[model samples]
Target: MILTGYLHQQLAAAGVTRAFGVPGYFVMPVWHAFRKDPQIILARHEGGAAFMADGYARATGNLGVVLTTSGPGVTNTATGVASAYQDSVPMLVISGQGSPTTFGRGVFQESFLLDRSASPAALLAPITKTALEIVAPENAAFMIDTAITLALSGRRGPVHLSIPLDQQQLDIPVPPSRSASPPTVGDVPAAPCVLAAAELLRSARRPLILAGWGSMLARAQPEIARLSTQLGAVVVTSTKAVSCLPRDHPMLLGHFGPGQRSDIAQAVSSYQPDVVLVVGASLSRYYANPLAAVLENAATIRIDISAEQVGFRMRADIGIVGDAREAVSALTSAIAAGGTDTAAEPDCSAAELVSAFQKRAERAALRQKPESHGMPSVAGTISRLSRMLPPDAVVIPDAGNHWLDTISLCRAGRTGGVQLNCGVGAMGWAIGASVGMAMAAGQEGAAGRGPLTVCVTGDGSMLMHGAELTVAAEHELNLLVVVFNNRSHGRVRLGQRLDFDREPMGTDIPSIDFAQWMSAMGLRTFRIDHADQVDEVLAAALATRGTVGVEVLCHPDEVPACLRGWIED
Candidate 1:
């Protein structure tokens, strides 16, 4: 059997069922192999392939895989892969390199061989947990196993493996031993930290569990729910973790952080958590800085996988370095031993707390003019779409105003999540991700199998990945892409106008009929202008079996609620 064949078996054993990439001659053998296996999907570009794999990983918590040939293919994938790394999504990228005989020879896409100056390994080193080059054919299986394990280990992120062309075609007589399943790491150590944390919580008057992207990475949703019920705790999450608790959950006060709903920010400003139990978060400024005043006054107990972040932005009274799920489980068991009488009766019921939050949100919305002339606000459209979507849908937002709007105005449903490119705020990230997510949901294969994917992006982002729509049409993916047609990089414009007090420049983008463009690309498409058309347009778009795109004309100067204070007439 050839090395490529053995590689497939290894991936299959590790439970990785799909790969994404575009084909190139340097990796021609892989193209032939893919035809026989057909486990890999063809993508429009290398970057799109990377983001697609990222979506698959987030949806299933499985290792996402992408393949590429040499040279520009490797370079094109860097930004997407790096964004995933920052978000700590588990992924592996496989690249084909020039043959060993070509070392130092001036061959196409063989710059790595010429001087080792522009090697793919060096290029991806900073973003990956580890990057490796398989120099020998016999060592391929072991290296493959190592890369997969690293990707799944502590602080889950991406890993890179490059295969030389000839090495992939090598014959092997003996089958390499494979691990039966993917490795799991990061568990709570049996230490005094758990006891110390429990003691603090046991005597607390008010407790809160603030979750983050890391919490979801640890698959601690059920544990979060259990702990909230265990302590009558108010639950909040970061932007990426909006669905860590269900929208309708009584104890769920919604997420906190920049651009999150005003009620959560108000809650953080008014009252403090006597004992703040932060789980799986690094307390990056993106989520933690906004709640600085409230947290600084609280006695904190943070549980995270990284020791460096156990006391990230502020000092923790008791810090535990472990897996989020394991730590939460351990802490729950410890707190339970003391009894359930720890929490005092609140001033209001859980239902009342939720109700008050809703009322505040309603009042806040009413304060703002929801439309300018005929253009609907991005906030209004997002809310309308959320109401019409199923509870299991996944909503992805690209970088810019639409991203902020989703964070500020929306609440995730019972099983759905808001997946964002907040790691680096890549502009066109969500377009391809929506395709990958829909496929992972198995929405195309059968009814009721998985959630629909909705990608909310801006026009500046749309042009970057218009080609991905073709891939979606080919798969007939259960997806809806809502392109906010503002014809500018809205975030950059905000910075220029609000921060610098200067008129926007170079932020303008060529306008295109997004609905027409999507229609031309084979997706069912709709165009919306008036506020009244939102629900009806969304219904028509969602009703289509395949991929759909809804282009919404949004008010250019309508500021998101989070930034409402800085507005000028």
Candidate 2:
């Protein structure tokens, strides 16, 4: 058997029923195995394939798998892999490479695949917990196991197992254990530090919880909520962490980003609790803006899986190096043991906070309307799309101006609906992710439901990997892809329009017929030129079946939702 066969078996045993990729000569052995496996999903672009894996991992919490050919194939997927790594999603990326014999000789598409693995791997390493390459076939199982262990370890993330083409072909002995086991989480120490931290929370009258991406990774939401309710803490989020708590949550403060609720900021500023508990979120200036100065006097407790985060820029009174999920559970148990149950819930205050924040959001949306000046604005467009989506539909967001705009218009949560580019903000991520989300939803099978997945993207980013549209049609995925046709790089346009004082440059590009392209792919398509046409087209697209796409042609000058203040006058 080729090592590829053994790798396939290992992945199957690891519960990876699907692998996504584009095939090429360098990766033929792995591709052959994938084809024979009857489980892999062959995608059109290497980037799209990786994103499919990303969506799978996001939906199932299982290790998503992706494969690619060498050089350009692998390079094409760097952004997607990096996004998975950054977001700490568990993924296994196996890219075929030039045989070790040609690695340094520059034999056709050959770069330093192994020696230089650490460089790109380093970039991903900051984002990922571990990365490696397989030099020999015998090392395949070990590397595979290692990748799984690292990916599901302290901070789950993407693991690269770069296998030379020769390695993929070489038959190797099976290791005693074929199935990869996730790494074991070490015992979290609940020392005097945790006790003191508990005391801080226990004593605080108005405690506020700021959960970040780390908290979600730690599975700290339930525990954090328990602690917050007990302590009367207001819970807010960093930009990417909006989904950790329900946006409709009474105790939930709105997201911390551009166009965020002014009242949430005011509440945070006004309530300025004596104790601030930050779990898994980096204590960056993004969340602590204007409030950074206020943090000087407040007691801070930071717990994260990444050691670097514990003392990155700010000093924490209590810092722990345990896994976030474990640490939170331990902290929650300790608080519970301390007779921390409070019969009096802060329901009334939470309701007031949510109401105040919504009012501010409404006012801000109104303020942005006048700035549109007849152009189709991102904020308004997303607002329409959000309403058009079914109550249970999954929204796939890629990274770019359009994605940022969608965030402002919609609310994402673990309870479902919005799935964002949380970790890495990978561009060209939406189309494939939409397919994955659609597949997952279709598997659930509810009668009378609309399209299960909706993808909102920009024209420029869509072109980057637009070929994936064919894969969606081929897979018979019922996905609704909405393109914001602003006829330019929306982000760059925003930058040029704002930074250059309205003398925009290098941002304008001629629009291509995206809807036509999708239609040619044998998928249903719709084109809309104005904001008024969006809801109607969206309704029709959702009503129609089997991967319908809508293109919204808008003015290039319209600013995205969050950047209106900075990007517009």
Candidate 3:
């Protein structure tokens, strides 16, 4: 069997039903082999292909696959690959390279340099968990299997494989058998560390549980909630884990980080916990560096699959290297067995904490009411949209002030409902990502029926990859794209205004009629300038078939309140 056929069979065996890419000469052979297998979703750009794959993985919790060709094709995918790397999304990037025999011949789109070993593999090495060049056809199966395993391993991330054109077309006498599944890491933590953590939580007067994306990846939401309830602790999530705990969970204190809402910030500042249990989070600066300062005096028990991530950005009093779900379950059981210290002083009862949180949330809502004049506020629109959407709707928010506003307003009712490109902070991701997510969710019994897949992006972001909307329309995907059309890069302008005290330059954008463009692309389009029109237009868009694009004219100066505070500070 040929190597190309073997590769496709292996991908199918691993449960990959779809692949995204832009076809090129180097990869034509493999493309032909996959013509009948794993439906290929043609993308307008290699970057869009990679972003689509990234979105598919996020939505389905499966390894996303992207195929591209040599030179510019592979280079174009760098941004998307980097974004996936930063977010720890599992993906396999297969780039077809010039033949190994023509390494120094300077063939068409040759990626290899004359003096060094620098090639597409080398270029992608830094951003991927593993990067390999398949020089030998015999090694294709091993390389493919290894790349797949590494992508899904601890601290999941993308892997790259550069296959020579000749190697891809090579036909060996016998095809290699499918490799065994990757070895699983044990979920149990060290006995001594678990005991110490249990004791600290059992005796602490004020305890907090901080969950991150790792918890969501581990499917540890139930364990986290159980632990929070048993220990009478408040739950605060990282931005990436916003939906790990339901928005209305009694013990939920809301998200913690730079983009936290004013009310959540107040609550986090006023209610200082004596101990914080950090689970499955990197404690990165995206949440703000001050998180470490806030918990400086508190006992911190950090549990993560990666030992390096245990004390990545903050000090950990007790570090446990294990799977989030298993470690959390063990800790809860240990705490139960150790018996709670009933005599320990309670700083605030669970009921009192919940009441305080609800009051703060109410105050925040009142403060965020849209004014009677000017374009609609991004936060206010998101708040209303959150209420209108179904409980299990999946929202993919792009990076920018728009996303920051979403973090403060939108609430995810179910786990893994909100997918944001926070790690790479890449614009234009949500546009293509929403298509992949909608495709995944539309599958029978995949995410249940009638679950809306929505992409919330800014004008700049929409223009970057809005071409993918055609893909959604062509596939008849159930997707909605809400574009905040502020006619400028609001975040960049905000930075310039605050940092340099200068009027924005190169930030303003010409007003593009996105509705018209989307309509031409066969998608239902709506253009609205007032908040009053939002509900009706959104309902109409949702009611329409396939994909819908809503272009909302927003105030350029309407920055997220959280971002405003950061700039002021």
Best by lDDT: 3
Candidate numbers, best lDDT first, in rank order: 3, 1, 2
Candidate 1 lDDT, 303-373, residue by residue in tens: 88888877667888888889998988888898888776654553345546656776666455444554655
Pitting candidate 1 against candidate 2, the one with the higher TM-score is 1
Which of candidates 1 and 3 reaches a greater TM-score?
A: 1
TM-score of each: 0.93, 0.87, 0.92
Clashes of 3: 0
Worst 10 residues of 2 by lDDT: 442-451
State, as a TM-score between 0 and 1, how close model 2 is to the true structure: 0.87
lDDT of 3 by residue, 1-569 (tens): 78888778777776777889999999888888777547688988889999999988887777899999887889899999999999889899998988878887877887787744359978999999989888876677777778877888788899998888889888744433454444444457888899889888888877889999888878899999999888778888988898898776788877877477555655665677889999999887777455665688788999999988887777799999998998999999888898654525556665486667766664664456453237777877777777778888888888778788777767788877787787778889998888788776753232224578889998898788888888888887878888888899989998888879999899998998888888999788898878778778777777776677888888888768675542222
Q: If the candidates were sorted by their TM-score against the true structure, best first, what order would they fall in?
A: 1, 3, 2
Per-residue lDDT tens digits of candidate 2, residues 1-569?
56777777767666666778888788788888876532677788888988888887877667788878767787777778888877777888777777777756657776573544423344344545665878876667777667776776766778887777788888777756564443454447457778777777776666667787777656566777776666667787777666676555557766676445444556677765677887888766666675575466688888887777788778988887777666766777667677745423333455476567666665555454412556566667677666556666677776667777666767654444567775566667887777666654543233224447778888887778788878778767767788877788877767765787676677676868888888898778898776567567777877887777888777777666665452222
TM-score of 3: 0.92
Tell me the deviation in Å of residue 144 in model 2: 2.2
Which residue pairs come into collision in candidate 3?
none
RMSD (Cα, Å) of candidate 1? Answer: 2.7
**In order, how many clashes per candidate?**
0, 2, 0
